[model samples]
Target: MSSVSRTSPTLATLPVDMVKHITDYLDIDSLWNLACTSKVFMEFIQDLKIRTGGYHVDIQKGSYRIELPAEHYCYCNWEEDDDYLIDDLNKDFKDFQSLFPENIDFLRIDPNLVRNFDRFHQECTVLSIGAHPMEYCRFKAETCPTEKLDLLLNNVNFRKGLALNGPKPLVTENKKIFNIDWLLIRNVTWITPEFIRKLKNKIVYLMGTESLTEKDINEYLKDLKSGKIDNRNLQVIGFNTGFGRPRYDREQVLNGLDTTQVLDQTYKVADYDKRIESELFIGTSSANGDIKIFRSFDFNRDDGTKVSVEFMYRTVRVYIWNQDKEQEKEKVTKKRGHAKDTNGPAAKNPYSHHSSPPPNVYNCGVSRYLLPGNIDYLLIDPKIAGKFKNVMDCAILSIVTFRKGLALNGVIPKMWKIWNIDWLQIRNSSIPIPLSMLYNKIINLWDISTITEPQINRYLLDIRDGAIDQPNLSLIQFRKQSGWNSQEILSGLGTVRCQERKIYKLKDFDEKMRMDTFLPFGLDENGIELRDTFDFVRRKDGVKCSVVLLDWVVRVYVWNQMETKKRARGHPEDKDTNDATAKKSCY
Candidate 1:
């Protein structure tokens, strides 16, 4: 019996409200010990979303890569006491989920763990199997069979992405992993060219291919070019030849592919998708950012669809560009007096979706708002705002006057990639940007500088009246208009007050925060702590949220909880919901 052994106490018998308050002071190890006492305590711990930070857990064979909490160090080894490996492996997996943090950043699974794969289907930010992270193939370790891998993967909803490591490449004709968010597979020779062509994932990185020839890659590129395969889902895909395998014969891959000319430039994965950004840069600096340097030759289909094919050291990649987006990139380039990647003028369509990103046109190191498919922060001119309603896909799109805003000269023609934006903040735009033109009504609006109280009232009325459908929308917030109060924001919504003194704080907004700076974006997280707040439940989603009023801003936050021990006990003075600010005495 170790320190984490079950304690004999009915912490579960405590009052519902008291349970959270009491457990909030416990350290991770203490919480683990308490959870072992009862299933009820285990669930309470899990629901708290303790964020247990991130664990690089090795179930067996002795390895632990846990991101330590600021206050404590954790050391609990199951492998150290696996006296009965056969019967207890499945029990051990369940115990891990029950005792530790549920939101693991990286969960390592190996041959031993998968034997009872049917029993557990836990979700993690990244799932590494037989983990192949290096450039070279494992060549001689026991690879997980494709079927056994599928058993666990098919049921789990991997939030950020998926990964397959190669002890020696395993085989699969078709598995659910192919259709997940990402497949960064090492010892990737098992994924055939036909398999690659059919992948429905957003980002695919087959680490090292054994049988993937240039001709096979060309065929896959053709599928993308011809629209035979859905190009929209697969925004980016790449594969390197196996270790000491044939170096890419660029000539062979390029042969018979109608090549569109490209330039010597770079693109960061971070510029495109925030999820992929975190996935790639895990355990690394945000600066190097798992950069996938693409120096490609363009290939166009007969119908004018284009794909960029780039070759690296024994690696090749195909970036599929949306047709309308490719055309608009040219127009935007021409407007800027910037040189285009090709000599020909682009097709004229302001409202087309683009595939590639214009190298993050801002000074790097500014923190990103952790939104999915994040188009990097951009300062777009209002003059071009009418052009496709300035349809740029970004987590934060800060609007500024053309003279005030700077657009970096991109070597490759830049276009709007129409992925969903999580936030849009408008600061200096003079003209009225229509709500409809804002695409999906811009999930969480921020600036609303020009927005009138009546307009906001109508927007809220529409949601309550079922005139609008915004399921993805978690919140709508802004700095209060002169003389506006929480009453004005919730006029017809008929909200109720849930708690007054319970001032919970949510700091997920730290570094992971607040984007969408065009009109206004809601930095309102689901895990918002509220004091003197009003609560409302959506009739449609049954989701509850709160409206918090301050001197300057009125925030409509989708009511959720901060991790148990993270609740702050003080007066709330700032809008950021930072726990530290609440504790610091202004006097």
Candidate 2:
């Protein structure tokens, strides 16, 4: 029999600092095992403990002591040795948990070490899976609750050949009991739709080499086209060159679809000097056939070691279907300015609701006559008529002109007359104006006065001065008072007034009103003619009489035949010399 060495390797055998450095990479199980191997290893681990204490407990002389309120417990350990550490440490940890009834908030075991989860019961909330493929697969299938699992795999093999078969039994058994929150896979290449389905509530984070055979790509495309795959649930997909030079353009990598037998996609590519390291894609699709893609790129450290990295990101185009059905539905249900009355079918007597008797024949308060189809014949109460006479005149004229196919200018008075009807109350009582009539009146009045230059200017001024305050003032009131209803007709005028005020406040009157005083007809300094030419004068026989004041003032006056002859002889244009001199003197 070969002689076996009794003394196992200890921390003293290696540099203490170097041994501590190695512990950083070892998982929790390795650390626990290292502590259990010997007194020296245990002492070293205790002395080099990395956790900063938020809560503390002191078990002096073998008696357990609680020092803080316990909500949950999390433990992590690391060690250098495998055999002496892993096997024994797991056994002791389980035994210790049984003796100590405190709850475990989360339990993470190194994949290299065997796990006995039956001892912990429901105490475990979080677990980690490492690069060991067989061990990870077995742990997921046996110990992990499918729905509750928080899988963290770093530099792990998740290729087609190494993938787990079907849904793990544990996942199926406990899915109703819990929901998976997260699934982190690093340096993983193959992830299937089935795998995604199994991890429904879980958000997946994937990194590393990404490759899909042409067949697989075609299948994915088929699913996208057929609506079998719900792309809305797919939150993110990312790709980046790892440890090697970029073999393909980043854009080609993202655009999954092929055009001209070449895939053209857009991707955020990191700089080469930055040593492009990783990429992250995030966001989900919408139910209405919309896909939102968010992409980010990371830069590797220049030192070639694991260090701080920089990331840049952008959201690319969103894919959506043009939905005409919604627009069509909106159009069908949309409300218009006028809708057919729904109180009842068309009235047998449309004029039965008339407020007054026919206008051509007054019946006072006794007889109600049908309102004539000809609005001019409709009778209004005397009191109302008196208040809205101008408005009525304007309205009647407008209706007559409109019916006669007259110009718009002739229809304004009729519109104004109808608008004035709003103030036609019964004595002291307020009479509600019919919305239809009021609208018609407004439309007519707007058409008439809106076209005139003087009316527009006055309207603008009234609006600017806030003279029209009430938005619901009656037209009858406006006409009787020589003003528009402050309430009903002035709300729209506020904006116009504000703009006019700003312009007027900023305008230069002196520069704009410059005058010229050189011409025969009262010309000002700015060369603007103040009077009409001789052609504008009225002619009587061969002589002309001034039709305007300025023209009259500019005509030459000859006291006698000799003076007239002299003036005529002097110059044909000298007839207005006196007027021109007068204009200059006035200036």
Candidate 3:
């Protein structure tokens, strides 16, 4: 018999799983070579689940990198490889595309190197034109990746005669010029209605259109209203008249619609030196209900030094976009099951007077430990507890406990009677809650920030007249940023001293003052410091108190012999031994 010829097994001869595992370890160039070797390998490479890092090549630097996920990269310094061919660069790039036709998401290419971008335009999402200085030049590509390429045009000069009719034709059908969704044209003083009519974009920003007039704007608005062409995709038209003699009455042009004048007067155009003083008019268009108008004026100062050169007059309008209809449609589509609204209240808007409180179940809060139990303290109404869920329970407790107490200078007043509470303890929180919560609940009123004299007088009258049914508040205290409005809260309370005393002198003290005030050490042998103490006899029903006013934390000093003995004996029931906790009261 004869001799037999032997051939090595091809990569495809192995199982697909083994081939996939082997390919995973291969570099970009090796994979590219492998795909080029045979049809079987090409099909295998195309079917491989590869996450492409965009096909980016910096041909100028003779360096390129194929970006991959998870920081795994394959780079080529063409300078190091003497065999690298610059003449066949386009052919090589086409080979990469042919291997993975659906892989390229974005391409950053030098505008000069691209001859007919249309021929090389892969079915991709975004095709960036120019380099860094022109990167802002972006275009939206084909909606479907396999359809065609699209481009985003940014910062491109569109001078009067240069853009529409030039030697190369700035825009052409072979380039698929009409498919752009966003167009940003700068340094253009004039854009004919016909030109604006032909643009198929959802949003357009035209800057430096100093030559544009009110008639042009009116025609544009009218065309938008009539819907002459199928530019329904056209949603927003933004343009600005450059700083010059012509000043359009933007408000007058935008008449016959609901408008709100944003009066802050602080605005500037993007990437320009000029400062803009304009009344931002936000409202729906009278011509087309679906086309909203957010236009502003470019006002000049008396010196004319500060002028607005670049700014879009109009922005996205919600009403014209049928926001309510869309919202209703979304609401219906997302209607899975009945769920309560989590936001505290519902109203027409922030400024609207109509509102209703949130559902009753929404009030559970951050510090549930401090929240008044439904039966124990009755500090908060269970039905409305959900409304105050966001505020610290401790803060509410503090405000409800201390805010209503009698404000006094010499001695603590009969706060228990006024607030219907037996105890008051207060401390400052790391995060302070708003004072309005306390002010509103105690006073039963609103708008605490701008409390007018009349409002204050009226509130005092209501309290004196018993016209307002104040809550049966007890232990009203709050750790606040500012001290309680002492003068306001204590206005009607007459000056009263609960106790007065003169301290007994110690034997060693010449001034007959308390020895404990000057002593750096503990009491001496004679216990002179003990005799220098002053005492106040508590009323039979006096309420226990612990109050912190700003930086000062004040507490009742009870010197009862039996309680001191209990504390010294380590009695578990003596709650006062722990300084951080409050002692429980029978009430």
Candidate 4:
């Protein structure tokens, strides 16, 4: 008894990674045996417990399932050691009780587990109590009372949620539990205005029960839209009539929640000193992606056409935040050097800058840009929204288009919403105009008084002969204006890759181009859209040269097939960078 015996080689002596690897293949019994060896091993098992989201127990059935870290069922097979298993389970329950005092993100309860409910109630943010069986049990020779359901509903321990199979009247016994974050109520017939008024959750899914009235539904929607519900965290709500579609209040529920609207604010040309920075914002209609819209802004060259911008983004939901005074100062400080102009204050010559070129330069021939002050409204267009399947497909189309100089300029509305990747096969019905072609001019006609044909020809020839890159693109008429300057208004030239054939696959060309069958617009003799189609036979070292003709101006695009799809239109990360930089400036 006095002699000390050395313990056998402990697995803890192995490296942590090795220990983890070995433990991964062990059964529940083996792991438990190892855990029993030392406190260190028990801690390691607890790590696995956390990673696997702990155990899920069916208290009534007296059954437990270990949830693996991967969210799959644990690979461990059950051993017939009932005594050992019960002991370990009790230990685990006690361990969790000691670990979480504030709340567990998710918890499930059954009648058998009600004894410990009080001790663990504070740790659960989501609680699910199994619906009591109502069907007549032949073995019992009687129908079960609603005692279990009553107990579940009246349980005071559940903090955030009490999932019910159907809605029930208020229980005075418990006087309601914690603020409900998830109300998965079926048979919504019991739901009333008063019931909805007291409900608080980020997500509410109502099913069955036709007891709800139009007025009560309207009040519910009104409260939801005004952020009076959900602790101001509501992100999604779903309604199902459980029969045919139920009719209730429409107006407030439809357009009341952040309906898209533009505030009364005029965009001055001089306000954008540097070339206009155009951006695209994208949003979805629901958490399930029932609709999506791409919103963008385009300014004219001379800044004369201020009326081009509109406010709408298909079926997408939007949230426009107005920058406070302090935010404006932060923005200015962050984008200091990017302004690129020091002439005068924008207030002095608000209309000095040139507007964008004519409507033909853009797709849809409509500019729906929203200024910062005007972005306070949101919209979820019913007309544009569809089933989740179609919405996901549209999202994919939007993303693929974005990679090709099309960009995303906005954020999704909530956390639970997800973009469906399988829906990418559906192509866009509208052809997107390249933003490069939209912005960063080689030469602006509004900046010059006059540019002659021969000079344009020489400039084009130089670009063709490789002496100068393609340049001098404008929409201005050389002879129409009075002022004449002999010197050429030549900005530095840049090259764009020309291709022998159209590079990527272009689907839905007819629908996207909106081709007129009888009287075609912008179509060549072959009926191809001339602006997007071009061919050049002139080859220097087997490279063809093509040019874009805009009124009296010419912009050449150098043929490079490899670089065709490599252009950076813009990126979603640009917004993040801009935001981070703005925030950093504040700091």
- The TM-score that candidate 3 achieves is 0.32
TM-score of each: 0.43, 0.23, 0.32, 0.34
Q: How accurate is candidate 4 locally (lDDT)?
A: 0.33
Candidate 1 lDDT, 1-587, residue by residue in tens: 65777766554566876666555445455677778787788787777655333444444333333433222234433443333442354454456555543345456565445555665465666676664322121123444666876777776556557766645565665456666666777666556666766677767767667678778876766666667776456656777675446667887877777686777544434223333433331211123333333356886765675567776544566665552564455465555423211112221121111122223323223223211233333333333433344555321233432211122211111223221344433432334545433332223333334565666666666655556666545445554212244455678877665433443334333322332222222123433334455555555655455666543355555433334335465424232243222223211
How do these models rank on TM-score, best leading?
1, 4, 3, 2
- Cα deviation in Å at residue 272, candidate 4? 36
- Candidates in order have lDDT scores of 0.49, 0.28, 0.33, 0.33
- Clash count (model 4, backbone only): 25
* Candidate 3 C-alpha error for residue 97, in Å: 2.9
State which candidate has the highest TM-score.
Answer: 1
Model 2 per-residue lDDT tens digits across residues 534-556? 11111111111111111001121
Global fold similarity of model 1 (TM-score):
0.43
Q: C-alpha displacement of 234 in model 4, angstroms?
A: 4.0
Please give, for residues 480-525, the per-residue lDDT of candidate 3 as tens digits: 1111233333244221222222111112222211111122112232
Number of the top lDDT candidate: 1
lDDT of 1: 0.49
